[model samples]
Target: MTSAPVTQPLPPQVFPPTLREVMLRPRWIALLAFSLVVAGVLAWLGQWQLGRAVDTSPPEPGLTEVVQPLDQVVQPGDYLPEPLVGQRVEVSGTWVASDFIVVSSRFNDDVEGYWVTGQLRVAGAAAPTSIAVAAGWTSSLDAANAAADELERQVSADPTAVVQVTGRLISDEGPSVPPSGADPLTITRMSPPMLLGRWHDTAELNVYRQYIASQTAIGPLDDISSPAPDERSRVNWLNIFYAAEWAIFAGFALYLWYRLARDAWEKEVEDLEDEQAEALAESSTSSSATGAAESRG
Candidate 1:
């Protein structure tokens, strides 16, 4: 009797789980949580920007509209206690000509040479105090020097001259990089420390609690003031915009994850069905082979 040929068993095939099945797994839980956190952060930033956009009221309408004497509006301790950030005041004092310092400044798209900063000695205060004043900027070194000279002539012409100065009270400018030069008169920038140091050389006067700027045109001058009308206040909303954009991206990310998961699940289900059909066919084939062998026997 001829022996039946032996058949080799087929290798078991392993199918990968579909995208949907993978998302259903516990491993992807952290990913989902992180996405939610990112979305929340983005939403928070947008709200913060919106708050900034609305929070700013028009510059204290009362202060800007009415021009009060600097001495009356600002006290000796006004700057120290932080009540002078936005207070507009007018000051009457004699400009200390010798104490003029040239500070680097820009105007009208061109780099105007430097600002002529001077100290003003307030007249009627019980104890005399000095106020800082930013006179103006000039194009050339000669012009800067001439401006300082002309200001000195004006101050010396009237020692007790009641020069009227008006401006918003601001904090002292901090120390800046000193200009590299040999000339003492030609400075690149003005800083609080530099001005204070020069005060000893100029006079024995104590610096007052505030600074001033001339509102009217003093001569052939262009602009003679610190803190212009269009100066920007704090509150940048770029971060908020970015946050909104990030939130939108997060939502899209979630959507993408869902789509991938669904596709994976469908693929997994199809694979499982194919496997079941393959198993059933194998079983039927085995049964048929057994019946044939028995019949032959």
Candidate 2:
């Protein structure tokens, strides 16, 4: 007969650990904490970029279009501040014919032109004062001169006439040297000091540091277009893209932690399943041998 079927001991069944259990391990816990720090930093960086994008868009207060009196905005002899630049101010004064001059290299509606500039003796000031004015623009030098000559004649005809001038306030263009042999009436810039040297009654006069680009013209001369203040800021689309990229990075850092943990858990599960399968096969073979021995007995 056949020897009784020898029984073999089966190994203990093993099962894969769950993610919750693995996360409790010191190594995984440390990794998760590190990921948290990295994600936090990335989030902060994205927020900083977002703040930069927001700051680029500035608010508009409509100061450029608001019409105000020049004396109310800035007093003569006082420095024109940044906020007052491009402001529309009205001044009523008589034009000084002797100070009328032409500025070359002026542009009107994107076309090169000349500007006829004059000084206006401010009305009812504490002292005798003047403010430079860009009276009109012309493409031809003769036309510019003709406008100046006509303005001088009109002002001289009625020296007491209070000409109301409305224009945008601008800062001094700073000092510049005219070309040699240039026309004595031609200037390269709107610098007040340069104009002051040629103005009359300086000993008793105070000149405003800034100048006005006039909207009104004499004798059909073209109006000098005063561009409005633009406060709208441009959006940096590239920065916005960077912000989105950073956000994705932050999310990926966390996802990487989960992926690594899940991979380890799945590998352990597969090994446990294989071990259990082998044990089942061994147990089945031993059972069949025992049955055959019993039948033979």
Q: Compared with the true structure, what per-residue lDDT tens digits does model 1 show for residues 1-297?
A: 755644435536667675756886875666677666776676676665556553355445354436667666556645533334545677777766577666665352355566677877777877667777767666666676677778778777776777777666666655565456655544444444467677633355556544555555353344644443443345456655665676677577677667766776787778887887798679668767876786687
The stretch of ten residues in a row with the least summed lDDT in candidate 2 is 51-60
TM-score of every prediction relative to native: 0.55, 0.57
User: Where does model 2 exceed 4 Å of error?
Assistant: 1-60, 232-297
Model 2 Cα displacement at 264 (Å)?
Answer: 50
Tens digit of per-residue lDDT, candidate 2, span 49-157: 8777654434357867888999888877788876568889999888887778878889888899889888899888888889999988999988888888888887788
Clashes of each: 7, 0
Error of 1 at 55 (Å): 5.0
Model 1: pairs clashing at backbone N, Cα or C within 3 Å: 18-264, 19-264, 20-261, 20-264, 20-265, 70-90, 130-208
Q: How many backbone clashes does candidate 1 have?
A: 7
Candidate number with greatest lDDT: 2
